[model samples]
Every structure is written in structure tokens, then in C-alpha cells.
Target: MPWDKDASQCAQFDRVFLVLGNHEFYGISREDGLKAANALEVEPQLLGKLSVLNQSRVDINRRVTIIGCTLWSYIPKEYQLWVRMKVADLSRINDWTVENHNTEHLQDVQWLQQEIHNISLEEDRRDLIIVTHHAPSATKTVDPKHKSNPWGSAFCSDLLESQVKSWRGSKIIHHWIFGHTHWNTKFRQHGMIISSNQLGYDSRGSRAPRFFNYWFPQSGQDFVITKTAKV
Candidate 1:
């Protein structure tokens, strides 16, 4: 079961956002029992609700605007079904042609950029929050194995670089929220580029698995981690 909406469990913070993990999609197409349902606490119906929220920009008045990117954007439907069929013992569904896959690449880029641009527009506010599935980039590349985890979308890196440049250039955008690394971290680079720790519900000691609460000041770059509680 997903985490119940106990607002008491979450500390008061400026904003909150979330992203999808590979496990969110791993069992989705075929409805296999994968991990994110528990780790990410995703109930079956609320899966694509993030996209709707991202597009509509709902709940902005509460100092919160959640944006989510779809997981496994790089893989085409045919390949996805092939992998699913292999695991599910079902016949292959070749719905994805090369042309469709190519189209997804372009749309995916636009989707990411649009979200970054939209969130960047929140400059009128004192703080800006960003949410996504994978980590943008590590302050240090400690893990040698993550170099090739298809789960970690490099396309996100490209988008982040552009967003950082835009933020630095326009003086907007500061905090980035993410998951999928299943680790917890709170660090900044050169006084910019910040990321929250992933919830460590799984048995991975990579990062301290905890939820983060950040307080963004109305002025100056004084960002602080207000609270962190283990799940």
C-alpha cells in the first residue's frame, strides 16, 4: 500500500514534488509486481496524475507546484513490450516502429524543456522547486556501476544543464528535487545546484533514505534543509 496522506508526517516546507522510478514502469505495462508501488508509494490509479499536474500547474497557491517526468522515455513501446513479454510469458506486441521511437525522442525533449521553463517562470516567488525521477548529476561519481543504468536517463542531464544555464543567466531556479537513486543527499555546488535525498525505503545504503523539507528564503540564496525524517 502507498503511504497514507498523513500531513502530520510531513514537516512544513515551502514546496514538494516527485518523480517516477524505473520500477514504476517496470510492472506498469504488464502490471507485474515491481518495487516502486511500495517504495514510491504509488497507488495504481495515480500513476499518470503527475503529468496532469505538471501540465495544469495546479496547487501553486500553497507554495507547491509538482512536476513529474515519465519514466523510461528512451525505450520504445515495441522494445518495452518485448521485455515485458519475455518476463510475462505473453506474446510480443510490436506496436512501436522505428518512426514512433524517433518521435518520442523529440516529444520527450520538449516535455522536459517545457517543465523547466514553466518552473523557471515561478521566479516571481521567493523559491523555486523542481521534481524528477533520476538524479541530475552527482557532485562526485562514486558508483562505477551507474554509468550504464538505463533507468538513469541522461536526457535529464541535458535538460538540467540547460536549466542551470538559464537559471544562472536569468537569476531564477535554485532547488531540484529528485528520486530513483534511492539515496539521500543535500549539497550544493559553487553555491548553486541543489538536490534533495531520495527516500531510502529499499535496502540500499547508497543514501540516507529519508524525506527532506527545505525552507526557501524570500530573499538571498539562504536555502536550508528544514527537516529530514526517516520513512
Candidate 2:
């Protein structure tokens, strides 16, 4: 309930972009979290339902864009329910369950390509931030099992790297926010790519490591941004 109000406050900014956390939908099957999100969506005063939707993206603000995606590997169906519940409301949960039943894994290479192309065409005046459920870059930390790694989505990363290079020649991609690694990271690449990892489950619980880097639009803005590249 509090997070709903908190999310509402943050999502109301001129630009707010969020990458899906692995556990975003994890507690959906539980009684508490699901009830809370469900309650939030119906709040008449909040902007909980005022986001823009496309085939594979949600433009939260004119300056902020979020790309919803699927996992690369086939997680247990029960575990995958967490992801489903976060994106869809209670009314559509059943339908999403039925439609995605027996699914293998998420393959969004084609969709990502198209979405990036569309984003690239937009003028460079506005900020462009890419959001995803997994870390597409190598700077993300990993677990021994490697399943919880930030670089989990190699395909998505390849697509992003190519796109960033191609477009950087013309446009400005300011940030990439993600949440799978659940670690705090800030790093850059070739003095170009800049990224930030997730802030953990709860701000207080485990204290999900987090970093915030601000870019100023002034004469001395050409300095390189800081980032934590895993490699």
C-alpha cells in the first residue's frame, strides 16, 4: 500500500523509467503483495493507470520509456507467475496465465530491434532511457549459479550494444536502468554507455545497493559518466 503511494509519487515526474525487478511479480501469488497492487490500481486519485502502452513498451512520460520483456530461460511456471501478476491487473491474470501456459522462454530480439529503431527516430532533445527485466550488459554482478546474473540477457545486450553504437553516432542515450541483478552498480563503457542496477527488494530490508548519477546540461557536461562494468 505504501509502495503504491510511493510509486505514484515517483512515477509522476517529467521523466520516470523503471526496469522490472525479478521479484516484482514474485509475491503475487502470496496474499499480501497481490492484494496491495490490486488495491493500488483502483485508487481513483492516483495515476496508477495513466501509462502509455505499445506492442512491447510503455511510455510513462514523454521523456521516459519502459520496455517490458520476458525472461530468456524457462523459469518454473509457478515462479513465472510473479512476472505476470506485476504487469497485468487481477482481471487479466487468468487470461495471461492461460495464454502463456506451457510457454518455453522469452525471445524478444525482433521486438527489441523494432522498438529501438522507433526510439532512435525520435529527436535527441528528449532523454531516452531503456528499461528491461534483466541486465543486458556485462557490468551486472552474478551469483554462483549464474541464474541471478545481471548480464542474464545476452541477446538483449547484443541488440542494445549494436543499437547504442549505431545511434550514438547521431543521438544521445543517457541511461539504462535494470533490476535483475539486485545489486548496486554504476559503470560506463568506452566513455559512452552508462548504466545503473536495481535497488534491491525493499529500501530498508536488505538495503538493495543503489547509485544515482545526474547529468547536467551545461558547458562542462562532456565529462565521462561513472559506471560499474562487470567485465
Candidate 3:
């Protein structure tokens, strides 16, 4: 696998973090996919630099903390049946039932809430960067084409209004990074930056210029995030 070879190259980095995506569960049982993700943490080639975030938190320093999970989309009650029948996740991922998916979403949400609450209570609160494979906001992240599609719920959750809005203007969260929509988006909401940098699949034989540009900011340069000083 490309990742097996790529893991060795991570030795040069001080740290590398990853969160499983829905595609990772494809062609395998959810249990097995999780096992594979967890195994990467101990891979010898990674030299302990790699950490797979699964409903977990990692403290980078006194000033920053990262919490991440593969937040599967929260399928709405009305779209539940349609999504189950129409979404490829159910058919391709072995043992992935709608019930299981919904349950996992709830668990991920609960975990995130608890982690944020605990961090907010700390005497010295650290800025948070919440990472998830699925976009956290449905209205904000959904592709325009999918906006009216019922199955669109399979791509994002309405966390922006349901939970994040209650964060009191994103006082603790510095940014949110997500990718699943395969569409690039960056916007500010409630005092926090929400963004996605996705290199979407090539259509037929050609790739979208915008996506290619975002992936190589030095060239087309749609948006760029730089580190001004060492942490």
C-alpha cells in the first residue's frame, strides 16, 4: 500500500497526526479498519511520530491541543432509510449498518463535547484544533450540487448549529480542519476558522484546477497556512 511506503518518510517529521476517513472502512469490517488504523501508531518506520486520532486528544504544547475523530455524518431521522439504501458505505463496508453508524456518530459527538468541556475548565486553557474526516457543518460544507440531495446528510453533520454554536463564539477552538466533501472550503464562523484542503479525485482524465491549486499552494495558491515561529 502507498501508506506503508509513505509511513517511512514520516521519520523526518517531529510528529504526524491522522484521522480515519469513511473510505478507510471500505472493503473491510469496521472493526478491522480500526485495528489497522491503531496499528499505524506503533509502526516501526514512523518512529513514534505518527498518531491516529480516534475519539482522542493530544497535547502539542502548553498553548495548543488537538482532538480528533472520524466523525461519521449524523444521518437525519427523515433521511435514515434513504441514506441506508443509497449510500455506498452500507453496501461496501462490511458490517456497517445504519444503526451502527448513527451510534458511532453519537459517541463521537459525546466524546468531543466532553473533551471540550474538560479543556474549557482548565485554569490555563489551550487553543484547540478539532480534526475530523467528515465536515462538521452540513450547511457550511456541503457541495452546492448536494445541497438539495437527501443523501447529502451522509457527507456532513450540523454540528455548527447543534453543538459548536454553543461554544460561546468558538473561544477555545482555534481552527477546524476536515475533508470528505472533496471540495475546498475556508470560512470564519463564530470566531473560528473552518477549512478543508481536499485533493479531489480526477474526473475522467482531468483534475479540477482549483483542487490542484489548493494542494500545491506554491503554484496556484488558493489558500495557505504558514507557521511563523517554532512551537
Predicted structure with the largest TM-score when compared to the true one: 3
Clashes of each: 3, 7, 0
TM-score of each: 0.48, 0.47, 0.84
Task: Tell me the lDDT of candidate 1.
Answer: 0.40
Give all candidates' CA lDDT scores.
Answer: 0.40, 0.42, 0.77
Residue-level lDDT tens digits of model 2 in 120-190: 67745555555455555544333324444332332124434544455432244455554444444456653
Worst 10-residue lDDT window, candidate 1? 212-221
Q: Of the candidates shown, which would achieve the greatest lDDT relative to the real structure?
A: 3
- Per-residue lDDT over 114-186 for candidate 1, one digit per residue giving the tens place of the 0 to 100 score: 6656655655443444555545554332133444544333223444444445443223344556554444556
- Lowest summed lDDT over 10 consecutive residues: which window, candidate 3? 222-231
Query: Model 2, stretches more than 4 Å misplaced?
Result: 1-19, 27-43, 48-107, 122-127, 140-172, 190-192, 201-231
